[model samples]
Target: MPRVSFVHPKGESQEVEAAEGSTAMRAALLGGISGITADCGGEASCATCHVYVAEPWIERVGAPGPDEDDMLDFAECERRPSSRLSCQIKITDELDGLVLTLPESQ
Candidate 1:
């Protein structure tokens, strides 16, 4: 298992353990973390699950693919170099302490 920390715009954060191989969006939703809407249900068709990978976690999570990048352009919030769709990030031991900052509107 790996752990993910979702940081809200208000500075609040929730850390939850997730099963390996599962998507970060699923973990956040099941953990009851706010700010990740995931309206497209991990299909990479919507940007509601947009999040910014913390500086340190960026490399670990890797960059979003073409489709995800396309959807990110439609996010309700401004984008950052670290922006990514949580649905595209899978939980792995290397990302055990991954920290994602939720967009204000997301």
Candidate 2:
């Protein structure tokens, strides 16, 4: 399992063990981490799982697919270079200790 750290805009941080192959959104939601809504249940249809991958972990997480990219346009927060939907990020050994920052609004 990999550990995913979520840092909220208000400075709260939650660290959870993410099972390999599980989406970051699923891990966060199951662990009770605030800020990840995952309204579409990882279907990539909703942008409520928006998050910003920390600089060091971005490359490890890779880029989003077309569907995720399109859904991001409707995220509750402003999009940025590091913006990504948590549902699109799968847990892997390479992503151990990955850090994600929650947007101010979602």
Candidate 3:
């Protein structure tokens, strides 16, 4: 299993262990992380699962795909270079200690 830490805007964070093939959004939802709404259920159609890949982990997490990038434009919070829809991030050993910061809103 790989673990991911989701940090809230105010700095509270929840760390969850995700199955290797699952998405970060799934892990967050199951772990009761508060900021990731994942309204489209992993479909790249919504931005409710938006998160900022921490600066140190940004390269490892990579950039969002074209579809995900487009969806991110509608995110409740402003998008940044680190912005990514959690549903697009697959859990893997390489991302075991990944840190994602949540926006003020969804």
Task: Write the residue-wise lDDT of candidate 3 on 9-100 in tens digits.
Answer: 99888899999989999999999999788888999888999999999999998888888888988887999999999999999899999999
Distance from true location, Cα of 39 in model 2, Å: 0.8
Clashes of each: 0, 0, 0
Candidate 1, after superposition: displacement of residue 13 in Å?
A: 1.1
RMSD of each: 0.7, 0.8, 0.7
Which stretches of candidate 2 lie above 4 Å from their native place?
Answer: none
lDDT of 1 at 37: 78
TM-score of each: 0.97, 0.96, 0.97
**lDDT assessment of candidate 1:** 0.91
What's the CA RMSD of model 1 in angstroms? 0.7
Candidate 2 residues 1-106, lDDT tens each? 8999999898888999999999899999989998788888989998989999999988889888888889888887999888999999989898999999999986
What C-alpha lDDT do the candidate models reach, one value each?
0.91, 0.90, 0.91
RMSD in angstroms between candidate 3 and the native structure over all alpha carbons: 0.7
TM-score of candidate 1 versus the correct structure, residues matched by position: 0.97
Residue-level lDDT for 53 in candidate 1 = 95
Model 1, residue 56: displacement in angstroms?
A: 0.6
In model 3, how many backbone clashes occur? 0
